[model samples]
Target: MKRRTRLVSIVLAAVMLLLSACNINMGESKEPAKGTDSGPKTEVGAQKVVFWHAMGGATTKVVDQLVANFNASQDKVQVEAVYQGTYDDLLSKLKASMGTNEGPSVVQMYEIGSRFMIDSKLITPMQEFIDADQWDVSQLEPNISGYYTFENQLYSMPFNSSNPILYYNKDLFKDAGLDPESPPRTFEELKIAADTISKKGKAVGANFAIYGWFMEQLFANQGAEYVNNGNGRDDLATESLVNTEAGVKVLTWWKDLIDSKAANNLGRKTDDSKKAFSAGQVAMILDSTAALKGLVDSADGKFEVGTGFLPKPEGAGEGGVIVGGASLWMMNSRPEAEQKAAWEFIKFLTSPSEQAYWHINTGYFPITTKAYEEESVKENLKKFPQFQTAIDQLHQTKLVKATQGAVMGVFPEARQIVEGAIEEVLNNKKSPQQALDDAAKEITAKIQDYNRTVK
Candidate 1:
């Protein structure tokens, strides 16, 4: 009893010290209150902030370069970026490390993971950090940041962002006697072009990666809901709305293309369909704007890549694209100094110059509006006119919950379930309506389980 009492006292003392050091009084509630502004930054000696991210391959090179620039720009702080596999892998590792002292000071979590991050209460809201410096975020494109804002407060900083776009082969278009400049803007027109291309044997009419993300975007394009409770923004989501009549239309269109052999039945991995396009086996594809740089590099001599706005469901919804990407979050469990250092790194990364460099190197769209004005960004756009399609799409987006995107704790799992349904339809194992209904049933059960834990 004496030893146990002593250990309890020690633990309480440590908790008090942590709370006081970060400017919180733990006597009030368990909720994480804001830290003090602490005035201007004072130089701290070689403080290292660990950032765990998910970027890999060529994009990882750009991430490392930005880190090098940030380190060279400052003497007081140093950032060490550690690659933690894909976004799904990163989220799993982050969850496993929560509340442990060994966790990273910062992490890059995708938009779908934001809901879990908030409920976990393991990170400082980026808005509080911004408020400390009284920084203005007016330059941030709302279409991108809107997805991260919850209850009127921004929780994470938007980093690499993009929306889906239609990528087509100009050479195929010319061969089919179709105008390369006038690609399809609606589902009806896409079929017309795909039919002509398939009949001509130039390549498979169109190819899709069987990605649930694209399916979600298709619903958003038609102003449809993927989940209930205003996409889990107004409150926690309890059921999925993705099995609706209009929602099934998306799956039907995709399934029909595969059945008609107009679109290749590429697997769930985005890379599969991308490789098909680069090899000149597919005439057109639908994928993220983040693929712009790689697509150009891979298809440099093979064919001219032409990009256009994502095709809308024939005459429906307010025609907009959902901005998708990961965001940088500062975990609040560490000392206040480390948290501040992480924020410093994030601020530097989002600056116009760094963002312009990032945009030129990787295909991911920059969140900062001023980045487009940079000479480097201008030069890149002049070299690759295909990028302007994404820029225009971003400008035309309206901030509704449908366009802002759905956020739920189980969204990652939800995506997997939807992908399975897509496979079934493509393989002719189920009808569009039957596939969606079955997926909705499974997703609804999972949502109920997830909500129970939160409550």
Candidate 2:
């Protein structure tokens, strides 16, 4: 018995030593990421590239189809597509794999993660490949390309881009005696419409989820900045502007809907609000353009859906929605051959035919203007005219500082802080001004921490 106990202790000590050497804890596993796949039997000597993405649900099928098509189209490269859970989860795994061979050759990151990805020095800028290949970037949509461009260079290739828009039930609008053809365009107008709809008792006026992305969009819609220093374009941001007048106005208006019984406090899960809207429990809701197809299909026979621009405060000017989707980034840690192969896949994915297929199957806007000329996209537009609103909004937007959106290394954390602040206001725990001020202080500290390390 003594010898057995001693043997067990020896094994435990050896395990601890191994863990320390690997820089991992017992609580963590070195397993392959979820949804990882070994590429379909590749041709001999084919370059193998691994792609990490956060897309799930039916979208995974589309990604797989695209990969299959790419693989079949060429014999030089075979790519394996992996789903790495949420954006936060994928980023965590990448951080863990830093300086190791476990990192992917290509990864999809959300738009707000641009600053962090750039600062990490882990990505090969898309501009490098574009210059090497002499590709014509002029074919891309200006508004979409402009979002990923910084310091006069494109960092990543835009994919699955979208922005928030107002969705309402046309049938409910008629029942409330509101104009079904014209959805509300301003905060005051939206409020009145909501009240009228609620008074009829058919449904609540609106149920905008307490999402920080929406708050950021609202600020941009009012030509307001979420952060200073040219929205972190000209220089690294050192302060947050969440407590500005525009911020206060947004929270006040959002809270007023609940207070006046025109809208419900549905918490922060957008899916919950989306489900309610589809069920006719709510007359209006704000959601990503990417959700348009799902929402319309869900409401097929139940109700007629209508789309409108994101509402802003009265007298606000020269503002528009920021691009609200993810982009494909090539990693510098990959081998030259693998990186080149990944670039080819990126180009193929953004081609007119693929972009049109993506745009029609999913509700995301195509990043390239030429995709609109594709027969599939034209037929899709005819089938669902609501989609044209998103396209028109993107083109009409003035590419200014506010509409360009903010960039910060700590954006993901800052968004969570802002969401918490919104909760405080909605729950009557803090006034909008006070909640925003507190949230701003928290976000500023995080930005300072991130800046220190990057600098």
* Candidate No. with top lDDT: 2
Q: All models: lDDT?
A: 0.87, 0.92
Candidate 2 residues 1-455, lDDT tens each?
99999999999999889988997644432433434432322445577888999988999899888899999998888899999999999989888988987889999999999998999998999999999999999988888888899988999999979999999999999999999999999999999999999999999999999899999999999999889999999999999999999999999999999999999989999999999999999999999999999999999999999999999999986799999899999998777777888999999999999999889888899998899999999999999999989988898899888888999999999999999999999999999999999999999999999999988
Question: What are the candidates' C-alpha RMSDs?
Answer: 8.6, 8.3
Off by over 4 Å in 2: 1-43
Candidate 2: count of backbone clashes, pairs at least 3 residues apart or interchain = 0
Candidate 1 structure quality by residue, lDDT tens digits, 96-137: 887665688889998889899998978899999989998888
TM-score of each candidate structure, all chains considered together: 0.89, 0.91
